[model samples]
Target: MMTANPYSFRKVALGDLDLLMAWQSSPHVQKWWGAQEPYTAADLADPRVARWIVSYDARPFGFMQDYSVHGWENHHFAHLPKGARGIDQFIGDPDMIGVGHGPAFIRTRLQALFDAGAPVIATDPHPDNAQAIAAYKKLGFEPSGPAQETRWGLILPMLLRP
Candidate 1:
């Protein structure tokens, strides 16, 4: 049996813009993530965020991004420790949902962050996004506070401490 994780992540690049745009436009993705403008060169070069393409068994099927919790002024997670990170992700391939890839890839990414000395990791999923909330819970995230509206949307703050 193959014991190694099947998920792999690669830094998203300019060349991936078309693919990413298509994924972002998918109905399932658009529902949760909203209409996002196309990423610009400056957006991709932003120092505080790391965007990735997630693949399972070498097939790209998702998008994920991690950012410094305190990168933006008055960010809800700013109170977290200095090295804390915030993550947002979605499985873009409709076929990949409910098949275990969300938690699996998220686990792999979170492990990498924790191993690199992140004191905590945070995620803010919409309160009604039960699937997302359940997956986060399975990965050990717990509610840090009540749901609140932010520029991004209404989210339930959750955190995973290393």
Candidate 2:
């Protein structure tokens, strides 16, 4: 597991597969979660798909990932060392929505990547998530146009100081 302490970031373990599959199948998360079929245990075990277990306050609250090189969207970050290590996440419990933790989590994650020298950080949400779009802007992400009729909403390439 890879962790940046004060905030714990751990590698996805076999035990996490089921939990991830739960998020993959959630109704609210589904509209924008790529609309792929519900994930099977074997799918979660694939080495090609990277996963990070996002826990907060002693409870699992979210999921983070960088898909396989052969997958969609990741092509935008294929130039990186790992081919796809930008950023993507979903808060598992709907109760956490609009509580302001999202902006903080996103800020921390991007800072962690930046300190590690990541050249860029990116994420795409379904165009309908107005709340998410507003949150990204709060974290300094600006819209960079749409992707395949899907508005990517925001992409934070590199944080530049003004």
Candidate 3:
């Protein structure tokens, strides 16, 4: 079995636009991420979302985003604490897929959020994205309830509280 790899996150910057586009286009990501339209400059500029490049041992290999769940107008998750946050991520490098890095990376993000005073952390993955859901579960996330239909798509709600 692959061991958990040390990882860090760097804020996504202007120079990373092209890289983000490419990763979103990768079939490995596209199949599960299901992003049909490319992300626009405005999307990247959204202040409500925090995006990061996932680096393993100082080498960039994936992407992650965290945002306040209450930031979305009338979001279903607004019932959570005011400090509740949500995260989504993907390993962009095919070579890194199926490795043991994802759970470690997610744990790091969760710790950062909790340290920053987020009382609740949540994630929603497509029901069919078993790999991603399993990763979240490994980190102590529980299926909060049934599937939710949102503009992005149908997502299986998962939650963690610290």
Of the two candidates 1 and 2, the one with more favorable lDDT, higher being better, is 1
List the global CA lDDT of all models.
Answer: 0.94, 0.62, 0.88
Model 3, 30-116: lDDT tens digits are: 997877575666877898899999999898999999998888888768789888999999998889989788898889989999999
TM-score of each: 0.97, 0.69, 0.91
Give the Å error, residue 76, model 3: 2.4
Predicted structure 3: clash tally: 0
Candidate 2 wrongly placed segments (more than 4 Å):
1-7, 34-49, 67-85, 147-162
Cα displacement (angstroms), candidate 1, residue 117, comes to: 0.4
If ranked by TM-score, best first, what sequence of candidates would result?
A: 1, 3, 2
What is the C-alpha lDDT profile of model 1 across 110-155, one tens digit per residue?
Answer: 9999999999999999999999999999999999999999988999
Lowest lDDT 10-mer window, candidate 1? 1-10
**Counting only residues 3 or more apart in sequence or on different chains, how many pairs clash (N, Cα, C under 3 Å) in candidate 1?**
0
RMSD of each: 1.1, 5.4, 3.1
